[model samples]
Target: MGKTLVIDLEDVILEGDILDVGEKNFGIIYNISKEAEDELSLDYVSSDTKIELKERKYDACTFFFDLNKIWTSIEKEKLIKEISSYLKEFGEIFIWDINKERGKVFNNKIKVILPNEKIKEFTFRNLNVLLSSNIEEIKKILEKYFEIEETKAWEDVFFIKGKKIGTKVNEEEKIKYEGTDYSN
Candidate 1:
């Protein structure tokens, strides 16, 4: 199968030129954003990524965030559940935050306050994922769905990589990730 990569439009790609690498290596590129459909066209006109403006499916997806965007425990759980539904099985999901350590603590606090049903439905058990935060409670939630492959902290960001327990199984489900593009 050809490699596919999905990126959030508001991500650091425009600033860091990360799209250059994905364009070179992946066969399909999907840009997801809350912006009007063509809003990002100008930004990518000169890039080699051959941006697929009409497609939404992808084998991998990336999200960059600040903990402040998630104000409540329920919001956090909803965000996770929404994103998980959009992912392909064995798909790689990357969540990055500059203050990831603080995010770890925030995640744990929210987990304690949220309901078990909310947590269970949104669990990330079907994909290969990397999270910038590393609170033990957050790790426990991820471990329920993925096999912990690695854990490390670098340049002030804590990260964990986990591979899904089985191969792709839920790709047939139709679920669109909601919320403002930059925020989700």
Candidate 2:
């Protein structure tokens, strides 16, 4: 059964479902323009690539400038799965990552101002592009847990928004994969 997870929910969330909105987290806590990246960099993830859930329900989540930083396709897929568990039924999710093709063009045009007060040409390569994928790949993974509603692009960045569908099929898959032990 190579088919992916399904978002079916019986005791799940719908548009009018009563969802408890927890203490909202504004994921973007830093303003890069107000600080130097070299002085205060915190984008690094630890050895565990797991996206742990908070002890509260959320109606919406966002991956503002961090999606591509996940270094592996498997890890990114895992992240999508983890996020799927964090939201209520019919919750919304938003993602923004730099487009691979357009990011190249955008990166090449970046000019850094030197300490000597002169601008020098530099190609930072999307500041560190790790998993730069197209819209198709994104839709494929998102469709596992959501019915993708919209997608848009702005220069080098792409955005996708979708609503959580259900969890019945996914729940069954989990149970199936976690079969009871039989030392056969």
Candidate 3:
């Protein structure tokens, strides 16, 4: 990937697909805000050296960000392989919260928090993208490189909504919350 503008779900839209499938606890909680920068203070990832913030250290470290790394009914290792190849040009890559304990280092290694409730796994990467402001501007900037394909999380939620079973919400739920619908 050449240039990418990563977005936090709560920052731009509702919650992002990444957090939905992530480990939850350590993934990175986001709140609704129209301001420039909020609590988490995340930023976007791009191809160029135009560093927006001074905290981004391009050292020999892996990048970890929320980018839809859930393995519910389908296998995500293949997706990770594809994305990993794309990230090789940039550097080592880690996604979501493969580990836990926010700033807590373990065994002298930068553990990647997976945000999972049951098990906390560690990876050798940190997050490269951390955008949390100006969605329209970020979208325009990202479209140049990443051919973002908008896909729903799980399809089984469509038939099992508000009932007793599936908590999964389909496009209809998204429409109800977004106040607008898109051509799916």
Please name the candidate that would achieve the greatest TM-score relative to the true structure: 2
- What's the residue-level lDDT of 49 in candidate 3? 21
The order by descending lDDT is: 2, 1, 3
Regions of candidate 2 where Cα sits further than 4 Å from its true position: 1-54, 101-131, 168-184
Instruction: Report the Cα lDDT for candidate 1.
Output: 0.34
lDDT of each: 0.34, 0.52, 0.27
lDDT of 3 by residue, 74-163 (tens): 233343333333322223222222221234321222222212222233233333233121223222322332333332122111000010
Q: Model 2: how far is 109 from its true place, Å?
A: 9.1
Instruction: Give all candidate RMSDs, comma-separated.
Output: 19.1, 15.0, 20.0
Assess candidate 2 and give its TM-score to the true structure. 0.52
Give the per-residue lDDT digits (tens) of candidate 1, residues 84-126: 4434455444443333433242222111111111121111111
Where does candidate 1 have its weakest 10-residue lDDT segment?
119-128
Off by more than 4 A, model 3: 1-69, 72-74, 98-184
**Candidate 1 local lDDT, residue 47:** 35
TM-score of each: 0.36, 0.52, 0.19
